[model samples]
Target: MTEQLSTTFNSLREAWLQHRPDERQRREDLLRLRSAFKASLPQMTEAISRDFGHRSAHESMLAEAMIVLKEIDHCLHKLKKWMKPQRRKAGWQFWPAKAEIRFVPLGVVGILSPWNYPVNLSLTPLISAIAAGNHVFLKPSEHTPHTNAYLTRLLHDCFPQNRVSIIQGGADIAAAFSSLPFDHLFFTGSTAVGKKVMAAAAKNLTPVTLELGGKSPALIAPDADLTKTVSRILTGKLFNAGQTCIAPDYVLLPENQLETFIAECQSQTAQRYNEANGQTDYTAIINESQYKRLTGLADDASIRGHKVIPLLSLNDTQKAENRHILPPMLVINPDDDSAIMQEEIFGPLLPVKTYRSYDEALRYIITRDRPLAFYIFSSSNEPVENALSNVVAGSVCINDTLYQFACANLPFGGVGMSGMGHYHGEEGFKTFSKVMPVLRKYNPAATDYLRPPYGRFADTLIRFLTK
Candidate 1:
């Protein structure tokens, strides 16, 4: 597998060296990329659902298929503007010289995408790279074989093997792919794997954008509407069974409103899905392994005396283990040292922590490694504004969740250990682009007096400029 990936990488690099795509060719390629996905929407949806072991078709379409389509449309409309060089003002010291900032295409870009939201993660970066006029080599997660096959075929139909391609394989291939020293490496996964990817890329001084997972917290501010707030939190947490990186990992509740929020959460979660089983719009864990891992998290929390409550009454349904469907759960006041509190709970287990004051909540969040996302639900903008001022995050959704990614105008990334760099909106274009500053000296004698030669005039000019 590693050998095959190496050979494919060589081929892609050679292709990039041979065919440097201009703006027009890139536009044509992007149009083809969007068209191919449009033609295969149904197939793409089905492929992802199958790989997820009963993933909701609506969720697949909304999160993966629909998001990719929107991203492509965004790139297509803005590519021309994004490609144009912007005139920058030359300082008075360099007066009579013209300056501009040009966005140059990096060579071959290598992307390592994740299984969750497979289509969106795989193609969003690809669109940005292509729009920036670079070739791409993508490797989708091995867990999503069905989706990978679809991507391999769909992308091939739109592009030649070298211009844009997919390499389908397991971890060995992934490790090999990361070490190849591509011009840029874009990765979306857990922080552990992100560290490994960055380390490998460091060998070649390859720049990387890691969209890694962290325990994102949603704060329920004072005067928040309990019903509306709970509904929004459930929408973010239960979507994709909480496999999203930006999904609210836990909820920080105002102590006075804890009971009201709990009641509302129970009601909202019940109304969101027909059954906790695999029969409704609710999704299953990707496989038996993930199912076990999530259950273990809950069980460990329970044994440690934390209150782990199932949001639904699953008494009448088949065992969740049998269907690999882990129901949504709420953990009340977990121990600070608990695994559920310390780790990125990527499942539906949302631990609720109470705060007596907003200062306490803000301080708690600040004490940890910066998260990929933060949610503030407040009736008034003042509290939200205050929290926003005090907190730092990769992205923030005010009075809601997961809507931050919907805007193609904003940059999405993490700070500190959550991850580094960004890849969405205009930031995505810049991530794959090399911003080169070009200065042309049309007037030759602009700095003649400042040049070497110790003269009274030179000294006077230097003193004047220095002053």
Candidate 2:
């Protein structure tokens, strides 16, 4: 085991040193990876579906495969500008000298990806690292064995193992992987595990970027259209059965519009997922354990006097035999201390809380740890601006959820308890890179007057510059 780990690390270091890629080479390699991804779209979809038991192929294509395709395009298009050295003005003390910022590649960046959206989460960072000219060592989650296996084979066809390698294993391997001294570490998982990863990386002094989950909230304003907002909210929450890290954890709606909001949400969910016996489009919980945990949360809330309503009642067969296919549920005004409210519900279960005013809604969110993402579905800008300014979330989307992560131009990450740092597009490149400030001197005699003596001319020059 020690030999295996050391071998992988040493190979990455040697590969990184053997060939430091320039902008043209980086773009060409990205294009090659891009073509490979597009060609294997069908296989990639099937692999993720097998991992999740029953993930929608359409969802997989859009969220996992195609998103990476677009990201590759974005990188290739912006590579020259991103790689260009940024010139800085020389100060009065160093007049006539040139100063610039150069983005240097960090060797052997370690990537720790999660099961949810494994393809995108794993390769998107890889894309950024490759663009920044770093050799990558990725460790995908063990839960998605099928997808990870496919990823291993697919990446093998594109590049040599020494350049960008994928390591697969369970928790023990993961613990050991985190402790390795990589140039940088990028992790995506739950907040509890994120803390541990951060601690482990600290021992190596490895700079880290953690993309973690929390109880992200969706707030509705008075002037918003329930028709459009409710439909979008349903899509966001039900997508991947709410397995998304940035999915709306809870809804804060107007007190007077509670019943109408609930009715509209249920209606939209049924419309989008119109299946009687079982939901073919609806994603299942990853496994039996996840299903039980989600059910436990719903059951605890139900027992504690919270109104638990299934968007669509599943047959006994679907509920009993097909337990992994968890039905969408709405919890009306769950108690603040309940598990549904306290814990991050990473399934198709959403709690709808009512507030009298915007202040009340904002207060409820502020009292908790800063979330990964926050949303407001308002036509007006005042409430959106207020929430964006007051809230300290990692990212905010006014009138939307989860789409911010799709944009390669935007930096996707968390703040506070949600997690730390960001990695997407240029930010991802910057995260995996060491930016060094370079100073060039054209004339040696430019500093001769102030070098040794601190004489009259030096004093006069200092006074002149200061004045």
Candidate 3:
């Protein structure tokens, strides 16, 4: 394994040293990868489902494969234009000198992908690195063993391992990966683990794009359309069983409308998944640990006078083992110190907090460190604009959540506690690239001033230009 990894980096360094691929060659490579991904979507989806026990294929397509395909297509179409060296205006003293920024690939990149959206998060950034003309080393999360195995096989089949390889294992392997002094590192997981990754990368001073998850909140003002509000919030919350980094972790609503909003949300759940226990379309939590964590939050909240409403009517008597089938839950007016609010809730629990006014809601959302994503469910354009402008987050959706990430033109990432850097779209290429600015003075006409030995006119010109 060590030999394989060393050879991969050596080959990528060799590639960068020997030749810089032209725009056509870069595009051809991206298109080939894109086509390969399109052909393998079904197999990838099946593997993901197998790994998770019951991940929905439609969810996989919508949340992972389709988004990845869009990103690939977007990059392929725009890379040539993005690759063009940007000319910059120079000062009067440097009239003959031209300055430009060139987006150059940073050799071999290391990507440590989480299991939630293994295919999309793992392969999408790989596409960006490829588009940026860098070889990649992808380490898909080992928790999803089946998916990781398939990813390794398919990537080795489609692309040369030395160019793009998938390394697999648990924490030790992940730690080993973070130790490698790659040109850049891209990681997606919890903020706690993200900090560890950052620390590990610090040893090599490797720049990283940490796509960490946070407790993203969605606010609904008094005048908002409850129907549209509940529908969108539920989709974001329940998508991947609320495993998404940008999923609505909880909600803030006007106190008077709390009951109305909950009723509508419950109704929406029924319409989508119905009341059946095991037949619910939305999948289970990733594993027993996650399920226990979520249930513990619910149990803890219920004990603290917070109302717990499991959207589906599932009896506690239903055959329960380590299967971890906790249904989507709604916590009403949970205490500020509740466990759900203590950290990023990456499960099927959505806590609903009631606020009196827009300022109160805004304060609640902003009081925490800037989140990965913020959401507002309001028809009033003023409030939406105010929220978007005032609050700092990786991304925002005015009347919805999570869908903003689906747009390949948009940059997806977090700020502060949520995360540091961004990826996706043209930003993805920029994230994996080192945009070094180059300046050249080719005109001999300008050499007279530079070659002077303290002549009065030359000194005067230099002083004037410096001033």
Q: Pick the candidate with the highest lDDT.
A: 2
Which tens-of-lDDT digit does each residue in 81-195 have in candidate 3?
Answer: 8899999976666777889999998888999999888888898888889899887889888879888877787777766655777778789878878878899999999999999
Candidate 1 per-residue lDDT, tens place, 1-467, comes to 77777777788888888878898898799889888898899898889878877788889888987778888888888888988899999887777788999999899999999998899999999988998888899989999999999998899899988788788888888888999879999999999999999999999999999989799999988889888889999999999999999999999988888888788888877777755443467777888788888998999899999888898755445354347778899999998898888789888899999999988999999988899999999999899989889888999999999999878888888888788898776788989999999998866564665666567888777788899
Q: Residue pairs in steric clash, candidate 2?
A: none
lDDT of each: 0.87, 0.88, 0.83
For each candidate, how many residue pairs have backbone atoms clashing (under 3 Å)? 0, 0, 0
Residue range with the least summed lDDT across 10 consecutive positions in model 1: 313-322
List the candidates' TM-scores in order: 0.96, 0.96, 0.94
After superposing candidate 3, which stretches have Cα over 4 Å from the reference?
1-4, 275-280, 315-322, 445-455
Model 1 lDDT, residue 353, Cα: 96
lDDT for model 2 comes to 0.88
lDDT of 2 by residue, 218-296 (tens): 9998888888888888888999999999999999999899889888977888777765635678888998888899999
Look at candidate 1 and tell me the lDDT of residue 21.
Answer: 89
Better model by TM-score, 1 or 3? 1
